[model samples]
Target: MSLIDNINKAFDHRIRLGIMSILMVNDYADFNMLKELLGATDGNLASHTKALEKEDYIKVEKQFIGRKPNTRYSTTPLGKKEFQKHIDALEKLIGK
Candidate 1:
């Protein structure tokens, strides 16, 4: 068996995984962008992000844009590493 063959360990939370998936395709994503893309509620996204933050997998930048609160999220180097591992495991499982 491969080192990262365990899906549960590789991707525990679907929302967080989805967040990483989207960020993989984009340079950065704002709070609303992730919410709309993942169809996750504010609290849901917030909680999931906290989880990733605890793991240092993602970085959150909070500030204001034109007097409106804006939050941007980007995957970290560690996040990219884990995400790529997850993708590889998934692809292997799918035999692709």
Candidate 2:
């Protein structure tokens, strides 16, 4: 298969890519942390996260922190596998 074929469409957007990249290293990240790291607005981040969630690439957890709501995100096993494939494909394409 072609290198391009290994790239996942779900991670096409920069925000989604950033999210996955962060999750790859961290156990989990909360909404504010992701927003700060990705420099995405609330709506933009929410949309991209929802897209990832729909693709089953990320798992979302909603809870209350002393009466305040909090949302955390982490990558699923499938997500990690697919994202690694995407990175490998990019590396191959770049001759790295």
Candidate 3:
């Protein structure tokens, strides 16, 4: 298959890619952490995160910390595999 075909459309955007990349290395990251790390606004991060959740690429956990709501995100096994494949495809395309 072509490299472009291998690239996951779900991770095409920089913010979404950043989210996945962070979740790949981190056990879980809260909404604020992701927003800060990606430098994204609340709406932007929430929309992208929802997309990933809809794809089943990530799992979301919501809890209360001191009466405050906290939302955390982590990558699923399928997401990890798909992300690795996308990375590999990019490397191959670059002849790396």
Question: Highest lDDT: which candidate?
Answer: 2
Cα lDDT tens digits, model 2, 1-96, are 677899889988899999999999999999999999989999999999999999999999999999999999999999999999999998998999
Instruction: Put down candidate 3 lDDT per residue, 1-96, tens digits, no spaces.
Output: 677899999999999999999999999999999999999999989999999999999999999999999999999999999999988888898999
TM-scores of all predicted structures = 0.88, 0.97, 0.96
Error of 2 at 73 (Å): 0.4
Where's the lowest-lDDT run of ten residues in candidate 1?
2-11
lDDT of 1 by residue, 1-96 (tens): 764455545357789789989888888899998999889999998989888888888888999899999999888999888888788878888889
Candidate number achieving the greatest TM-score relative to the actual structure: 2
Global lDDT of each model? 0.84, 0.95, 0.94
| Cα deviation of 48, candidate 1, in Å | 0.4
Better of 2 and 3 by lDDT: 2
- Give lDDT for model 3: 0.94
Compared to the true structure, candidate 2 yields what TM-score? Answer: 0.97
Q: What is the lDDT for 1 in model 2? A: 68
Off by over 4 Å in 2: none
The candidates, ranked best first by TM-score, are 2, 3, 1
RMSD of each: 1.8, 0.8, 0.9
